[model samples]
Target chain A: MNMIEAAAVHVRFGDRVVLESVDLAVAEGEFHGVMGPNGAGKTTFFNVLTGRVKPNRGRVLLAGEDVTGLSPHRIAAKGIARSFQIMTLFDEFSALDNVMMGLPEFRARSHDVARAAAGDSRFAAKSSEALAAVGLADKGDIRAKDLSYGDRRALEIAVALAQAPRVLCLDEPTSGLGSDGVQRLAALIARLKGRLTIVAIEHDMEFLFSLADRISVIHWGQVVARGTPHELQQNEWVRRSNLGKFA
Target chain B: MAAPLLVLDDVRKVYTRGRVIRRPTFTLQANLSLDEPDIVGVVGPNGAGKTTLFEMMTGSNAPTSGRVLVAGTDIHGVKYRERDRLAIHYHQSYQVRRFRKRIPSAFLAPSPTRTPLVHLFDEPQFNLQDGYIGFMLDFFRKLRDEGRLVVLCMHPTAAWHLDILAEIAGRFLFVAGGGVTAVANFGALVADPRCRSYLGPEMTKAADAICHGAVHSST
Candidate 1:
């Protein structure tokens, strides 16, 4: 069954049409990639899916339930966790503390889970596991503020992963990292491939091609093409419209 | 070389929990200097004292030992008004609560207008949206364009703002449990195409180390 489905969705930002009759679906354990240019409304689509923004029309279903107008936190509680394209993190707190905040649901799951794991043991175990998965286990304790630009982007993914969501949505996960950082993040996502449903919006064609099982191209707020990576690489319209320069 | 924009000399912080006390000392013995714009990443474990280092540098909290100097001025020993003029510390959380309560009252009070030279941001990404994010980006951009230094205490996730941040400060330091491990020039890490993906593992490790170090060191 599809974890998330958006059908005939329309969204506007003060009359600027961001999405029009959009249809998208994320199946369980599927890694779907959303590709587009800067103003293509990739982030807006994510916002709509996660209930951060309300769509003017159409219905959004999460696990077969209508969740079009729910709040972001509520959607997150329903098993959708997102990492910002612009990178969002708690600066003053240590990286571990930031990761701990992502586990509010898990923290609420048990009382002893909070007090007994206040130190770096349980939190470290889970946070470090997520960090190590992303190749950031070594820097877990460093203040989020102290990381390099690239490292910060990776840390955001780690924070999202710590939430242990059923559906993980990432916006521009590799916007500001080096080659090594990109490879590591790709590998990290690859590791999570079969375990979680992922919807990634990216401008980096190479990264998307490497990680995405299915690629959907959005242009001017519409899905111009949807196919396997091979199919996308061979699509003439996709090449002309979005992949022309990159391909 | 010119003196560092900020310097920490024999900085020490000791926290006591009940009857237990733990004190960690950090030293920057070598002359650390920033002659031009650069982006530096400080990488270490949690307890390595990154926040404490920032507190000492921004003059929010005093070091048990040593001194923090900004622009060659001793911040801890300086008068309150003088310190306010030199730097402003931005907490991780906007403390919307405090802003709602204190800022307006302070503004209405007979306090002198404060324009901080260094804008310290703890978690700059916390509760940030399009408008506020744009405001912060523009604010720092103006400072950077005008050649001012802004120190950011940010998480790895929010590091995407580093490009704009570097445009302003041009230099960065990565502080972890072990102290400043990596210092890079401006656009050094961001300019690379692959740096974005590689960040995941590096940040995870650095954060892990700091948290582990902090907990153990504190205990």
Candidate 2:
């Protein structure tokens, strides 16, 4: 059964139609990639999936249960967690504290997240496990700002992982990373591929094409094309362009 | 027998400057009928009123004179918020122009359909590297096959851009100097002297190559 589905999603801001009719169905444990040019309504579609923006029409289903128009916090609690394209980590907080702050248990228990992270053993263990999943277990003591750019990205993923979400929605995870950073991130994503359902919007075509089980090309606020990486690259124009070089 | 998909019945739009003097700065006129489901390519130079023409077609900007019909329903007469049900305009960035409402939405007629009959894309950016061009072209065909009129307005800067326009569009509308000229096919569009001038030397050569069946034979 499909884990997350957006059916005929339509979003319009005033007279401008942002997403015409976007339909996507990501199966359980599948790595789905969403790629599109800038201003193609890719982010808006992400927003709709994660409940940041509600569609003017259509439905978003989570495991056959309708979850459209739910609040962001409600959606997050329902096992859909997301990381932002622009990093949202607290610069002054330790990596562990950031992850702990994301833990639902920790958030529910105390409003003082920084203090609670250090005092609570269960929360600390859970945060450490999340950090280890993203290869940041040893770097938990360091402040987010002190970590390398790559480590910071990993830490952000760790924060989302702390939620133990069923579906992880990543927005431009590979952005602002060097070649080495991208490779590390790819390996991390590879490790988590089968264990978790992932939906990523990425500009790094090679990264997405390599890791994604199936990819959807979004343009004009709609899913313009979709297929496996090999199937998509078979287009004559794609073969002529740099994207074909990946194959 | 069924109402034509889209019809611009002698539509005219005039943008005038100076509220008191009301001197006309720009004017665009179009009279055409797309009776069937097909992808119609729109090409023209900058400030040739392509954007204005799209606005009028989608009912965002009211025509100064005539009617813009989508499957026999006059879009201007439709409810303000529900106008998109008849025709939707995907603007470039946040270039959505706001026009004054002449009549209250309660007085306007409701849209006859749920989905837009006329889809007008204004200069949608087509990037080649990501390989989304193929998908977009296919989507245009899908909309056409669903019995909808798809109007694509593009500013052809590259050779491949012209290739895409030639390949995807069954007909062409060359908008220039406030007038719209409809061409039946790609070969005819390239043959017109005004279109040649608008395309420039490099693009014109590419367009001619496409017309002679010398390019993009792969698909």
Instruction: State residue B185's C-alpha deviation in candidate 1, in Å.
Output: 58
Worst 10 residues of 1 chain B by lDDT: B96-105
The C-alpha TM-scores of every prediction are 0.50, 0.94
- Chain B TM-score in each of the candidates: 0.58, 0.96
Which pairs of residues have clashing backbones in candidate 2?
none
lDDT of 1 at A86: 79
**DockQ of all candidate complexes:** 0.01, 0.58
lDDT of 2 by residue, A44-129 (tens): 99899899999999999999999999999999999999999899999999999989999887888999765786698888899999
Stretches > 4 Å off in candidate 1: A106-121, A237-247, B1-219
Docking quality tier of model 2 = medium
The true-versus-predicted C-alpha distance at residue B89 of model 1, in Å, is 47
